[model samples]
Target: MTNYDFVIELFIRVDDAMKNMPKHSQAKLYPSELVTLGLLYAIKGVGERAFFRWADRDLRPLFPGLPERTRFFRLLATHQDWTERFLAEPTVLGIIDSYGIELLHPVREREKTLVREREKTLVREREKTLAPRIATKGKSNYRWIMGAKYGFLLNQLGLIVDWASSWIGTRPRKAITIPSSNP
Candidate 1:
């Protein structure tokens, strides 16, 4: 199908699904409109400012009442639950995986320590914040790193089913759970 046809079909499906959801009387944008914008944003994979600009210029005809950036973001945040549910529809097969998200480079640790020492007088009265106390040392297949872990569940089509993150030292079993749809 053409891109226009696909978008129309997607909007129809999303609108029908969201029809039974709760609504805010003061909301200027309908759930369908919000979801459509969200899908467009995700597909475009652009930052919020750029997406807003594109929508303002190209999609204004389709979304005549598009709000300003701040209001648009607030609307998205308010309707996040609906969008999440719509995106997480079940699939035939799924995969779960995780990897480390390094917050700081090991080489930078020494520099950080030196900086902290220089600023000791300024932060003397405050608590002594240490890296070990904050981030745990963890090992990945490739290398050892000190950082947090990010986990995700993806469907057969590679869409994110769910995702989470935890401290580096935490095990995936304890940090993440895949909810059973059976009951």
Candidate 2:
């Protein structure tokens, strides 16, 4: 079917979904029309002005009550509660993904000890800063610099629900206790 036809179908579906809902008395557009436009905005996946233009140009015949550009968006914002009933249930499934960021490269970054040695005068004072979290296992010839690992949790719709960063967790330190000679 053509694009206009699809819009009409979408409106009908929204209308059917919200059949029990009542429209506000002073509202210019019907409840169904407003909800359809809102859904269209999301489905069209365009900026506000562009989406409005698409509707005003192509779907004006279907929605003659379409208001001014900014007003239409305002109405959509205010009347968003109407679409809640029609929205699908949030998916139970979610996805988690993580990535590593190399904040300090060995070539460009200096070790804490090296920095202290370079400035001998500063050696008497304790180092105030920490080294970058080190990364140990890469096949590349370049020495791996310290980095952080970041993770995101996304819902079924690919919306980010939460995220976290390992600010100092990637440091490579293993346990190795040495026996005292006196003992």
Candidate 3:
């Protein structure tokens, strides 16, 4: 059917995209295996681990030979930049956003000096500068998130024209402009 061909074309496109990516050393999974894994991911739209099993069963015949899970992870970590480039591609003909990837929570390390300065500022403010925080529910009925609403401006091609991220506080934080270095 048409859908089947679409999937096949998408897989081929994924493989083609991998050609431009950086390669790795050491004997492990082939770049083709990594491409198949990525295609399976795009089609299934599931978690990373799920795609591995899917690749083992459904994709094995397509690849005919794939390294074990260890090799798969190794290949994945080694070629992470390719994954980012693959996801960032304007395949949809417009901007797209995805948060499906469950990455490991990074270790939180506090900067002692920065924390001390913030503490000093808090002390200086005292009760005179204390502002009562009011909780407001969003129109969507989603749980109240104590954060500022942020949006990134992307052109029609989906490349980030600019990005602005700010933390929630008494007053709106100033938007910092990110210049496009390419131009």
lDDT of each: 0.77, 0.70, 0.51
lDDT of 1 at 52: 95
Q: Show model 3 residue runs off by greater than 4 Å.
A: 2-7, 20-28, 87-153, 157-183
Residue-by-residue lDDT tens digits, candidate 3, 121-181: 6745653554343222221123333434444545466675433433332232445343343
* Model 1 lowest lDDT segment of ten: 123-132
Candidate 2 residue lDDT tens string, 18-121: 88878778877888999888988999999998998888999899999899999998898888667647433334676767666666665644565588688877
TM-score of each: 0.64, 0.50, 0.44
Question: Comparing 2 and 3 by lDDT, which wins?
Answer: 2
Compare candidates 1 and 3 on lDDT and give the better one: 1
Off by over 4 Å in 2: 90-183
Q: What is the lDDT of residue 141 in candidate 1?
A: 53
Rank the candidate models, highest TM-score first.
1, 2, 3
Candidate 2 accuracy as TM-score: 0.50
What is the per-residue lDDT of model 1 for residues 1-183, given as tens digits with 9 covering 90 to 100? 965677678888888888886656987677788888888888989999999998888777777778999899888887766776765654767888988888777677678778869888865544365533567667765887778888888888888878777777776534445667686
